[model samples]
Target: MASFGWKRKIGEKVSKATSQQFEAEAADDKDLADDDEANWVHATKRRKEILLEDCVKKSKELKDEGANLAENKRYREAIHKWDEALQLTPEDATLYEMKSQVLMSLHEMFPAVHAAEMAVQRNPRSWDAWQTLGRAQLGLGEIALVGKQTRV
Candidate 1:
């Protein structure tokens, strides 16, 4: 009877120690995973930020070159430069607006309208885009579409 009691006590002690070791290991693993996740997230965010900065810088350079070309009356070259800028910033309403004006200078009515429409779509609240769209529509001989007379 005494021997049975001693054995039971030893068995309980061993089980408790094993459980504590497993708990400690689990905690360490969780800490490692959390650190790894945090590092990965931070790196990804920084990489995206760097890429956006680069794109904005390059787009600006292209836009400036295009504006200079347009000012010099090199309409086709200006259009080409603006097109490259658009590739970097497709959602830029100003780029589309500039392209629309260049196309108008070239008497490309269809393309001008298309570019103006794209500008309007990208910036619905922009007065310049709306004005460009109206002008392009008028140039395309869509005077009826631009306005209609109503009896007062």
Candidate 2:
């Protein structure tokens, strides 16, 4: 009788262990299925190439307007327009160059130098920005000389 009872207990333990293992395997399979579904959803989304092209076109238009204002000798107004262009595309070296030129025309030498420096910072490959910076520095030097002469 004692032997029979021990055998029955062992059989019950084996059954519970098998049930726990089956539940763990089912959970892992469900997680894998969820991951596959997420991947499929992401693959079906549309790309945004056209929107990017439109932004570039608008930036060019604003830059052209800034140039027109500068050519008309409206330096402050040109700077305002260039500022708008910069707001649209802050990484544009040409817009910064235009702003620097406009500021220089208004005799705002320090601000001109700062704008040129910003252009170089935004695109270090721009020779135009470097030239503008040099010219602005020369203007500042002349102003400094004038101040010294006046002090004498």
Candidate 3:
């Protein structure tokens, strides 16, 4: 009976040791999973920042091209380039104003009005945008006046 008691004690100790080993392994696994998740999140953030930087760079290039085209009096092409720039930086009132100017030169009254309106939306306090809007409105008014005169 004494030997049987000793054996039971030894068995309990072995079972307790095995359980402790399994718990330790589970804790290690949990730590590794947490580390992997943190790394993945950091990588994703870096990728997004890189993409945004690329877009900003491309927007700048397009803006330069738009300026060159406008200087050459290629108003339609300049407007197209400015539109591409705006896609990358939609908040730029300057781009919108430039596009509005191009459209105005082309005598595209409605589109000129719309582009000036977008410029105002991007920056209400922008003097250039306000001026562009005023000019576009004047052009539209002139057309309307002409139509009325013709009808009469």
Candidate 4:
């Protein structure tokens, strides 16, 4: 009976040690999973930032090319370049305003007005946008739309 009791004690001790070891391994796995999730989130944010920077750089280059083209009186090509820039930076009010002016030079009144309106929508405080809008409206024979408070 005494020997049997000692064997039972040894069995309980082994069982407890095995249970503790499993719990410790589970904790380590949970921690590793948490770290992996955190790393993924950080990497995703960095990728987004990189994409934005690339877009901005490309858009700036396109805008400069468009400006040079416009200066040389290549109106259609300038408009195309500006359109490509706008695709990258749709919220750029200046691009829209420039496009509006080019459209006006082409005698495209409706499109000019639309582009100028988009400029104004993007930057309501831009006097250039307002001026372009007013001129485009006038060219479209909508003088009534060009109110006395025209910023231009």
Candidate 5:
């Protein structure tokens, strides 16, 4: 898991303040407190959610920029922008799928295949990711066959 230091601190502060307020409100009622395990899980989830929102916001901006670049046929520049987005949201399967498509267009068979594999691993149910992987594999096979034919 990626270290989200600031996100965790902010989340903890919010949770602590909220908990204290709730405690004060319930002081006279004597309500039972949540167990340690539940508190820990809730804190962890809140921290993760905050970090995910931040990354998603940043990554979406970069992905949109990459899409515009790709529309202009600037494949390499688009790939660079997508690469930046991936650093922010490494598990975004769409980024991986799109990056592999650009790599395939650039005839980077191995890297295309690798990116597609990452997409598949990130989201096994994503048909777009599977499609990109299939295209890369097919392209690589075709290239190998052509090479063999020339050698013979």
Candidate 6:
């Protein structure tokens, strides 16, 4: 019974040692893999660029339709079309600017300000966005001063 107990203990130690050694080798392989030059984040960025390109065409079509509606002074329908275009490409600064224009036509100064702000945030380099934001701010200020007798 004593000899049998010793054999079982030795078998467990051997199995544990083997497992540890295998795990150590696997870790070493992972360390080597960490040095690989094929950085995957750039690949992901490229894929995102491709997806953005695909969205561009459809979003532009919706935007053009919205523009025609806006030209006809159909502001509400234009807003709906703009909303769908934005859903297709939410990152588009131009869309936000257009929506801000429609909101201004509706005299919804607060919402126009919000939309213009979104356009600026999406593309700070866009002069149109900055201009729209400035206009919205002016409109809001005018409403507060003249309509509401407010300070802000």
Highest lDDT: give the candidate number: 4
Identify the candidate with maximal TM-score. 4
Candidate 3, 115-145: lDDT as tens digits: 8889989898787887788788888886564
Report the lDDT of model 1 for residue 103: 95
24 Cα displacement, candidate 3 (Å): 4.3
Best-to-worst order by lDDT is: 4, 1, 5, 3, 6, 2
lDDT of each: 0.90, 0.78, 0.86, 0.93, 0.86, 0.85
lDDT of candidate 1 over 1-152, digit per residue (tens) = 34544334545557887988988999999999999999999999999999998998999999999999999999999999999989988999999999999999999999999999999899988889888888989998888877741111
Residue-level error in angstroms, candidate 5, position 2: 61
lDDT of 3 at 54: 97
Worst 10 residues of 2 by lDDT: 1-10
Q: What is the C-alpha lDDT profile of model 2 across 66-124, one tens digit per residue?
A: 78878988777778777887776788887888788788888999898889889879887
Per-prediction TM-score: 0.73, 0.61, 0.74, 0.79, 0.61, 0.59
What ranges in model 6 sit over 4 Å off? 1-53, 142-152
Q: What is the alpha-carbon lDDT for the whole of candidate 6?
A: 0.85
lDDT for 117 in candidate 2 is 82
What is the per-residue lDDT of model 5 for residues 1-152, given as tens digits with 9 covering 90 to 100?
87765534545456877988877989744533555567789999999999989999999999999999998999999999999999998889999999999999899999999999899899988878877887888888866644553354
Off by over 4 Å in 2: 1-48, 142-152
How far in Å is the alpha carbon of 89 misplaced in model 4?
A: 1.3
Question: How well is each residue in 18-137 modelled by candidate 6, as lDDT tens digits?
Answer: 988988999998876775434566677889999888888889999999999999999999999999999988998999999998999999999999999899899988888877877787
> How accurate locally is residue 86 in candidate 5, as Cα lDDT from 0 to 100?
94
The residue-by-residue lDDT of candidate 4 on 11-64, one tens digit each, is 555688798898899999999999999999999999999999999999999999
The lDDT of model 3 is 0.86
